[model samples]
Target chain A: AQTVTQSQPEMSVQEAETVTLSCTYDTSESNYYLFWYKQPPSRQMILVIRQEAYKQQNATENRFSVNFQKAAKSFSLKISDSQLGDTAMYFCAFSRYDNYGQNFVFGPGTRLSVLP
Target chain B: GAGVSQSPRYKVAKRGQDVALRCDPISGHVSLFWYQQALGQGPEFLTYFQNEAQLDKSGLPSDRFFAERPEGSVSTLKIQRTQQEDSAVYLCASSRTRNSNQPQHFGDGTRLSIL
Candidate 1:
């Protein structure tokens, strides 16, 4: 079984600042994927970024990026120049390569607040 | 049309009642997934469908929960004899392919409240 773990329950960052959320997972599969999803008060889950297990280079999308360390099974999300709109519940998810599609295993989330 | 959509943004049901939630996947999408999210918790996988075929349903917590995608585009999740524990947001997502690299597009979940 694959399990994702997000250590932070709550995080706060000032507007224009940067913050990082830590995530770790346990999986024996060599081929997998990692993702960071953000859910606002509207309860809509939004994809932030994703990383492929085989790719040594980390993934970056606009102001969001991931620090993926495959050996340690660590995937952390970094938000640069945070804005109020970035405030949301961030989830870390892992998925194994499968024929039917990937089965996502998500960690408990981290509530982020950006103070202006 | 551009993104995944879910019907009945909010649903309130009495215990033992049956409830059905609908999801419309993005046009041309081939994969659809259902997840359950309790308050303050992350979404948990419930089922997966590929082109009207239910490929995976191992994540369903109980036999009372069932999901189907008859035409490969629109999907429904049905819960029979719902319990208080079934009170959670039902989320639907879709992707262009079943590959792990494809990012999924999510819909604003249907919040199920069981009384």
Candidate 2:
């Protein structure tokens, strides 16, 4: 079984600043996928960024990026130039590559507040 | 719909009543998933379907829960004799294919409240 952990329960960042949310996972599989999802008050889970375990280079999507250290089993999300819209609950998820069902194990989540 | 669509964005039911939540996945999507999100908690997997076949349902908490995607496009999650513990947001997600690498698109969850 794979388990994802988000040590930070809540975080706050000033608008226009940068913030990093930490995440770690335990999985025996060598190939997998890591994802960060954001859920606002609307309760719509939106994909922020994703990283492939096989890729050495981190994944970047505009202001959202990830620091994926496969050996350490760590995948952290970084939000640069954060805005008020970035204030939401963030979750880290894990999925094995070969599993067609694509069952994702998710972390508890970190509530982020972007202060002006 | 351009993305996954869930019906009854908010549902309120009395205890012991049965409720059904609907989910319409993106056109041509081969995989659909249901998750339960309790207050202040991450979403937990409930079931999975590939086309119209239910591939996995180990995450369902109890026999009181049932899900079906008979036509493979629209899915429904039914809960019997709902209890206060059953109050939570039900999220539906779908992927273009069954491949694990593909990112799943989610719908605005249906919030169920048992009174």
Candidate 3:
């Protein structure tokens, strides 16, 4: 079975600053995908960013990026220029690649607060 | 629909009552997913559907839980004789395809409160 771990239960960052949320996973599959999802007060789960295990280059989506260390089994999300809107519950997820009906294993989550 | 849509954004049910939650995936989407999110916890997969065919249901915790996508567009999750432990947010998501590479689009979840 695969499991994702988010060590930080809560995090805070000042507006305009950068923050990094740590995530690690345990999976025996050589090929997989990592993802970060955000859930705001509205309770809508939104995809933040995703990284393919086979890609050596990290995935970047504007201010959001991921530092994927395949060997270390770590995939961290970096949010640059944090804003108040960025405050939300962030989750790390893992999925196996090349599988039909792939299910995701998610971490507990990290509540982020962006202070002005 | 422009995005995934879930009905009965909030549901309150007494213990032992039967409840049904509905989800309408985006048009042309081939994959649909259901997840349960407990308070302060991340969403956990409950089931997956590929165009009306339930391909995976290993995540369902008990036999009381049932889901169906009769026409491949709209899906429903039914919980019979619900228990307090079944109280949680039920989320529905959809993707263009069943491929793992595609990102899923989610709907505002239906919050189920079992009393």
Candidate 4:
């Protein structure tokens, strides 16, 4: 019943530049979690950053940070000083807890390329 | 490795053949999850396990798909009479517990190609 959307199919940024990937979701649950995952050619989905819906404060990890707008149902990732290694398929995911564990619902994904 | 481990990084099977993918979650992890990701698409939840109990399997695509975690650590996803549509990367993830805030650690995934 919950869905995540990544509007950008592909994006490119010059090295050392800044890039922001947009994401939005539809969910009635007021309490939930938003996440950004990066999947490289190696086939592993690595956690970039996560934001709790209850926390208005954005989440930051090194060069990766999230602009979480709960009311707007938008969660965006901003990568500063982008490097070549940042090139990957970035996915926006949603998860909310249940009696056992939460289920992860991921967006289509955005392919990012960092050029020199 | 400290992270989740999946076997046979790549698998090629003929149509209608049976294939089994393995996943080894992190030691002491209480929750494990399985997902299927098609080409150019995001991963979709297939099943979930809490320790040895399969609490949720609502995401499984069809009756041909089966998953089991007997010891609460190692798991296997078996597909019987596999079809072309079953060709996708099977991903496994684990977390410290069945908590909302716990981040899931993912394995590299097992890419299954149907020929």
| Candidate 3: C-alpha lDDT | 0.95
TM-score: model 4, chain A: 0.97
How far residue B104's Cα lies from its native spot in candidate 1, in Å, is: 1.0
Give the proportion of true interface contacts each model preserves, from 0 to 1. 0.83, 0.88, 0.86, 0.78
lDDT of model number 2: 0.96
- The collision pairs in model 2 are none
Task: Please tell me which predicted candidate would have the highest lDDT against the true structure.
Answer: 2
- In terms of docking quality, model 4 is medium
Off by over 4 Å in 3: none
lDDT tens digits, residues A1-114, model 1? Answer: 888999999999999999999999999999988999999998888999999899999999999999999999999999999999999999999988765688689999999999
Instruction: Point out the worst 10-residue segment of candidate 4 chain B by lDDT.
Output: B95-104
Output the lDDT of residue A33, model 3.
88
- lDDT pick, better of 2 and 3: 2
Interface RMSD of each: 1.2, 1.1, 1.1, 1.2
* Candidate 2 residue lDDT tens string, A1-116: 99999999999999999999999999999999999999999889999999999999999999999999999999999999999999999999999986576788999999999999
B9-79 per-residue lDDT for model 4 (tens digits) = 99999999999999999999999999999999999999999999998999999999999999999999999
Better of 2 and 4 by lDDT: 2
Q: Candidate 1: which stretches are off by over 4 Å?
A: none
Q: State which candidate, 2 or 4, has the greater DockQ.
A: 2
Worst 10 residues of 3 chain B by lDDT: B96-105
